[model samples]
Target chain A: MILQYLKLLKDKRIVLASSSPRRKEILEKLGWNLMIIPSEFEENLQWESFSHPGDYVVATARGKANEVTKRLEKCGEKPYLVIASDTCVSLETQVFGKPKDRHDAQRMLSLLSGKTHDVISGVSAMLSYDDGWHEIVFYEKTKVHFGRLAPEEISSYIDTGEPMDKAGGYGIQALGGTLIEGIEGDYYNVMGFPLHKFCSTMAPYFGRLVK
Target chain B: MILQYLKLLKDKRIVLASSSPRRKEILEKLGWNLMIIPSEFEENLQWESFSHPGDYVVATARGKANEVTKRLEKCGEKPYLVIASDTCVSLETQVFGKPKDRHDAQRMLSLLSGKTHDVISGVSAMLSYDDGWHEIVFYEKTKVHFGRLAPEEISSYIDTGEPMDKAGGYGIQALGGTLIEGIEGDYYNVMGFPLHKFCSTMAPYFGRLVK
Candidate 1:
């Protein structure tokens, strides 16, 4: 649907400031040329300080974008755009990131069993201008309903080791998909980026070509 | 969650009676040993003959399973199980399949623009018993909501050559994801196979190991 933007954005120096392969794959599907630059920002933000989980993720994503942008500028490399994103699973007041260990993954999965949780992703786009960098930050939330998981189920899933590197101790694109009952929002949001929201948000920057 | 069934089902001969790579990929994610044997049944069922789209798809899936089962029996190759599936996109009473040409794809995409549609998949699992074959059939539905698409956007999407081979003229797991606002139900269902539903439905055959 965005094929028209191919010519306009093809030559732009777009830097993706995250190490997530899922996010990179999503962007590549749109046929954009991207430069991968993992953010060096320490993700030690106090989740309790933020009033909402969405705010917390957006702040972290902005932190990543700022770090990568400044690092590039210091190197005298000014890119046209820098994109960063953070995803977390939240149940009520609690926020869950990657599991620290097998036990932590088991704990997180147990808590999420037979319950509905929110998959929140915060994205920041740093657009380079002659004067400075213009930042746009936003968050997308998707409701995920997990099936009733038995103790054995959680243990087996942990053994697979897929939960260790994923938020909420699960990756929806792989075997973790079997653990989910359904979802009530953009499916891509669960993967760490909101494709539709990102496209719509950046629609203005590409100019009103498609209308 | 289903790791317990690995040993029990690993040695068993499982034949998948469809050529769709998406369905094959979904099943493979479970770490199951699968034998790809695409069905020879022709998908020429009249859509108007059925009372509901779900019924039509189920009948089609059954036809595929029956054809493959009989064909294998003729060759004296009775596998443990045979699975067949059919997927279609329905906007109210109208059912949409693969687009015939570019104009047809544009027409289908235009009808689906800025609207919600149901992605229905019918599955049939045939198990061989001493007496004969025991069959289980079911259908899953997922609601997909698409964002408003401009004419150029639709044309450009068609140009990508993805719409010609996919039902509803889009693939939600690829560039089509950007065109979708959100979805309600198992995301895999929209991808041509309902992973969660398929796993849950076959839970009984796998036996109550986790309990």
Candidate 2:
């Protein structure tokens, strides 16, 4: 369905700004040859600054993209398309990011057990194409529900150490899949890329920014 | 993660008793060489017979497996394994299967709009090994929420002809994904297989399913 963008992405420089292996894997699945340049921007932004959780994620993503774009600009590189994303888990109104430690992971898991939560991923694609710097920001939210989990089950899952490095203390793409009872949005969004939205939004810039 | 079943399945005949292209695609991704033999058993059984929706799906899946197994046995080619599954969409207490036509599709979509629904996939695996016939049945349910969909959007999606064939009038693996707001459970189950559970259940027969 997105084949129209393939021709445009054939010869452009693309950079991904994130250390997330999940995002990297997804982009690679689309057959994109890009350089991974982790953004140095701190992700400790105050959630209260934004009125909504989505805005917070968008701001974080924009920060990452701008950081990378500025870095590449200083390197004398003509211009590259930089893609950055941030995902968070929200239950009711409480937002959850990467857990600070095992205790935090356990807390997050406990809160999510038997309750439905939202997984929101904000994506920003910035480039120096079209004779100017342009950026597109979009967000996808997926609802995920955790099955009723026993305390021991939660403890043992934490011991597996999979939840420590993932947002909301769970990695939906791996062992976390078992804990999930269902999801309402894009699966890849929980994994950190809304491919459908990404492809749709980048279609216009395919040849110029991606190739 | 499931690499242990390879040796045991090397010389065994596996049959997939389903007509779902998505299931075929997923099984291929799992690296299993399976023979497709779509079941001919009628699915006209009353849903009320089962106390729970999950049981209904399990019974349907078992029926399919039994139909296929009986045929294969009479043909003098007993498959080492016969896998069958049936998926349904349940919102509140109402269960939805494939829409009978466009009108039915629209009704199903309308009912699902702005609401969370449960996707129940009942899986049955039957083995006709040297000892005898052994079977296991289970159900995986995923809760999916749909964003409020516009009438035009629903009409356009239906025109694409994707919903007509999928239970619940939506295919989570395709264009229908765009309509989802979130989900909680196994993504593969909504797409018609509980892959993790399948692997776990098949482990014993295959010596060890996951590596």
In lDDT terms, which candidate is top? 1
* Chain B TM-score, candidates in order: 0.96, 0.95
Judge candidate 1 at residue A185 and give its lDDT: 96
Residue B49 accuracy (lDDT) in model 2:
76
Q: Place model 1 in a CAPRI quality band.
A: medium
Q: How well does candidate 2 score on lDDT at residue B63?
A: 95
- lDDT of each residue in A101-162, candidate 2, tens digit only: 99899899999988988888999998675586889999888778677776876776777678
Best by TM-score: 1
Residue A194 of model 2: what lDDT? Answer: 84
Mind sharing the TM-score for model 2?
0.64
Candidate 2 residue B106 C-alpha distance from true site, Å: 1.0
lDDT by residue for model 1 (A64-173), tens = 99999999999999998999999999998789999999999999999999999999999999998889999999999999999999898888788888999999999999
